[model samples]
Target: MSRRVLIKTLPLHSNYGGILQAYALQRVVRDLGCLPVTDTSKPLPLQRRLRRRLWDVRRGIRMSLPARFDWRWRSAREATASQRAFIARHITGGSFVERAYTRRGRALLARRFRTFVVGSDQVWRASYADLPAQFLDVVDDLDGDRPRRMSFAASFGVDDIAEYRDGDRARVAELIRKFDAVSVREAAGVRICRDEFGVHAEQHVDPTMLLPADHYRQLAARAGVAPAPATGRLLVYRLDANDHLERTERELAERLGVPSLELLPTGGPSPSYREYAQNRSAYDLPSIEQWLACFASADFVATDSFHGCVFSILFNRPFVVYANASRGASRFDTLLGIFGLEHHLTSASSTAVDERVFAPDWASVNRVLDAERSRALAYLTANL
Candidate 1:
């Protein structure tokens, strides 16, 4: 009988990457002869939620005042519905557990699963890292009977470990030390683990890359994505949009003589841009399959999202990444470096639209990807 593996990560919300990664990790675990499950637990208490909300609101205010009241709320509601539908359709193993934010909640989860896997996202970020539940601390009282602990592609979401408070840092270190096998998503994460926590960790690719490209193609086909456009268009999946990026995209599209289609961030549509007056918006929050299909069908992609760049590479489409510093630049650096596509990374101020057309050496890129896939597979199989 396959061992029951329970995964703990950020909740499946509007974030496409987070949802897709969770699905991918589940697939990886199942392929390794283990049953992978997730906790469909609800959000924590009102106090915690309020605190987190306040922090997020503060951050949004810092970034863009308008973002605080954009169509994101409606878009997120739609996106959440779509995400739930996708999870219901694709992920088959787990059943929803009640809200599990407290000590009792962790105990209940420990009792249900023999192996607890934490990873494939920034679950270790300071904001969410302090929770004992995330660390599998509920099982600590079980003594020798404690469940197996492992992490796959977990990220710190920042370059430095010092981003956490002194107490949080110590707590996180202790929890990490208890993991049987740990692997991080970024090279900086690997260094942080080794240099700061003294825990040796292997660098692994994002879970989305664990599956082959054809897997996503099949999903797109199932979703009924239209065939590639005859007069191909420029697809823009900008998570953090600003005037400069918008102008650059328009300029690039104009130069390439292609109509532009912009996939706005989680919320709703932004103010109209004259540059994109001829452009279109994928305003209806698309399902995960549709999202993947959008990337597959695009002639060219311009994005600042980590997963957008990821899918662009998967489809072997010509693309450019406008690195979003606030969202975490290290992730882009690590992923782009893996495919030897560092040249594609550019800043918002850059007006060099012509460089976006350069074709990547896919053969060399695939070879590196294949090797990394095997290593990630080995880590999952051995640990699980």
Candidate 2:
């Protein structure tokens, strides 16, 4: 019999990084014959004061426009530029997105599944306005029966946890110890869990990369992305740099006058809303593969996000990771170091301006990926 595992995530607001990770996990879990169930939290009617706070988080903290209505409902309005760029490069046409959360909705999810597995992304991050803490407790949900629980490669970045207190950490330790297994994507996460939660975490690839880079190539081919460009001078967004990164690239484009394209991840301001539901998260917007053709045709890469860095490595494309001094240097730094490709990396201040592809070890990266995949599979199988 298949184990019914409800996959939980922070409210999906249209993030390719998060969507790709979740989709890849669901896909692999299914391939492994593990039930990959979708269970979105139901939205609740916010009091006037509470609504304002949530809106601030959705827009202020993370720069996302929280829809006035439910976020679980998928819609077709165009996305912001960063989201569009993400769509053009990694995800395909929008499908399987969500836009609303309600108490009734949460009830449906609880009724639909038994066990729950959370994260391959920042679902645990405080970035989300209504965290899954709504669904979790120091030991269990404050009132509801607990689902069988585990966290697969989840992260809160390099930040410390503020929610656990009043012996809550110990209570969470109870929850952590109850898990059949746990895994994390970054070394920092490994350290954090061990140091704070008393759970020795195992390292695992983001589920998206577990499938192999060639799989993405095949996906592109299947989706009709013709071929890699012939002249080959693709400037991927590896820099953790911000608008300045764009400005620098613009200058480079002017000087080189060669064909170039940029893959921007979703983040930033939202359109004016007629109401709360007027805007939606990028993850709720569309799939990156819809525009994967753009990246498939790229000659090289640059990016700041961890998965952005991973995809570049997966494609064996020479890429530079812009150290974002803004976000306390992404966890990307730690993961890249783990792979021994540390030399290919540079921080935002590095003089490595618009660096080109250097010799990289695809064989070595894949070897590491394979082992990580096995470790992840082992955790899942043993738990089931």
List TM-scores for all candidates, in order.
0.83, 0.71
Tens digits of per-residue lDDT for model 2 on 1-384? 876666666544456666677667777777778667644443344575477667757655433545434232312234534454543454222211121234454555555555767676765545452343422432242226765777777765655666445465555666667666677667777776788878888767677776766666676676555556423655655434466455555545555565565454344434334422443452233345543444545565556667767777666666666556444354666668767777666544555453333557778877876777787888877664
lDDT of each: 0.75, 0.57
Count clashes in each candidate, considering only residues at least 3 apart in sequence or on different chains.
Answer: 3, 43
lDDT of 1 by residue, 183-233 (tens): 899999999999889999999999999999899979878767654531277
Which candidate number would show the highest TM-score if scored against the true structure? Answer: 1
Residue 145 alpha-carbon offset, candidate 1, angstroms = 1.5
Off by over 4 Å in 1: 40-76, 92-107, 128-132, 229-231, 265-283, 349-357
Per-residue lDDT, model 2, residue 237, is 53
TM-score result, candidate 2: 0.71
